[model samples]
Target: MPPATLSRTEQSYLLDGLRSKPAERADRRDLHEYRMMQVDTDLSLQADGSARVVLGSTEVHCGVKAEIESYDAPHVNVSTDLEFAPWLPPSPRVQVMVEYSPALLHEHNATELAMITDTVQDMLQACYALTGNSIGPLDARQFIVVPYARYWVLHLDVYVMSWSGGNVLDAVFAAAFCAMYQARIPGTKILALDKAAARQDDEVDQDDPAGIKFITRGRKPSSSAALDDAVDFALENEWDHGRLLAGREDVPVCISIYPFEDTYLLDPTLEEETALSSSIAVLASARGHIYGIRQRGSGELTLDAIHKAADVGASYAKQLAQTLQARFV
Candidate 1:
């Protein structure tokens, strides 16, 4: 006689067993522990800055290239693209392309594709908002070489190289942070404004060869001792751009929590994700301030669950920020 196959209900029961008393997962990791992650910075010599991140089986790459443009307002342009390996089995893919111009929005039709695009755009915007309206090290105000005349335009490109399981948002954010941490901008010096020339006339001298300067975004030190230490560190390690950027206390990180029955799982794998009833993605700073919260899935979360998830997410974000500082700085 042929062996009997388990029904859908039976299969679900078995999977639930992995999450019940005396729970056992293939990786043997605790429910709260995230998967192994590896972050490599400055991977591209051609780009201004670049990083590659591997979280569990997922891999993401980010590159930043900057140019000086004549504009009244400074802006940071972000774009994302995704490509799957041909050998892999067919699966759903999300692609987001953001342009600075408003004309690109009309190209999207009112279909599933449009929804995916909109979702991706919202996520990116949340990331930017969490980091103080800037995706890279320097904000628009700092990028301006000449007020209302010349400023730096940064183009951040992110690509999903591989996807196996786990949260892609965490991986993408990590890669982006690393890339920005390694970025350096050209040195600029102000010149006297020419009263007779047009306002659009170039006010910055591009031929200066004094050398590039590393851009830093953070609050000034509160004490003289801290300021002295920072200056000493900078003078001793002038070549270390990544360290300076990574040391910023205001840098934010993301945490994703999924609700599984009565329990909540952190950095859930593909199997756990499929079994999840609802999920929340939290973007928090190192100091545990919740900057962004996004919910998904068919099930609803109670008020208590939302608060618990936020607390858990904040703790995880703090830990992640510390780890990145230790590794990169």
Candidate 2:
């Protein structure tokens, strides 16, 4: 039910109970306690990496795809919002997309959906984006094959299968972190680039109107003498030979906090989230480094409240990271 649907009596009861000494929650959980979560990885044989995270009723899946791309693609500078890690390199482009299921869409309107997408994308990009200032510790040795010719580009697709309750951001980020950690970049075989051969392969399209000409890439038959030295790059078929993604343990884990009158809530249910006036999502590493902090509520927050939220997020991040890392070990 929406916040408006909460009866006045119920709201009063909630507020009184929360404000009482040793605040109480709807489920009798401590302020730092979290809902039970289930995580799985290596879910897709085709994807470089894949994982699923289930928290309360929310289920999110993250898949990692890496493709070899040329330098012809346009480059983008670091985004203003991505002031987290400041990762450099235009190649090995990383793209993140978050999509929701029809069932979830029915519960939320376009605005809510947009907000979810935008928030999740920003958090994921801060750590995983290659073009921006990334809080993620993506190592160049993981995907870079050639310096200027070609590189591995990543496509991280996060699909929300369901949203029942609890912190969706935590679920999304956890799934993505595991998937990226499990990612393996394929090995590439490269020969010297043949500039002369490429020049000779340019073909003229004769169908142009008014004597206009369009140049297109042409290929020679395998048996033709022109293609004997044309093979410049190829991928190795053996999966075992591929390199594992670097900084596998460095992805930031996020903890979302909902502040009540004089207390805070961790892993709040949908109703609890709606009732609260403010929310803070802290993206931090298990190694005791703070990546970024996002505040989404309009409630007036004191300095002490912010610090408490950060401390909670940072402390829980280590525990969450341990939980995720255990899966690989």
**Highest lDDT, which number?**
2
Residue-wise C-alpha lDDT for candidate 1, range 1-329, written one tens digit per residue: 00124467855864776667766666877777788898888788776778888888767787777566654322222232211111111111111232222332343233533454356456755554313323322342445454334555556677766545557667776776666656666555554332312132323334321111111111122221111211100121223332233233545677888866667777766556656557888877677877778787788889888888889888888888777767656
Q: Enumerate residue pairs that collide in model 1.
A: none
True-vs-predicted CA distance for residue 308, candidate 2, Å? 3.0
TM per prediction? 0.66, 0.77
Q: Write the per-residue lDDT of candidate 2 for residues 94-156, one digit (tens) a residue.
A: 788888887766667767777777878877776655432232576544454442345677899
List the global CA lDDT of all models.
0.55, 0.69
TM-score for candidate 2, please give it: 0.77
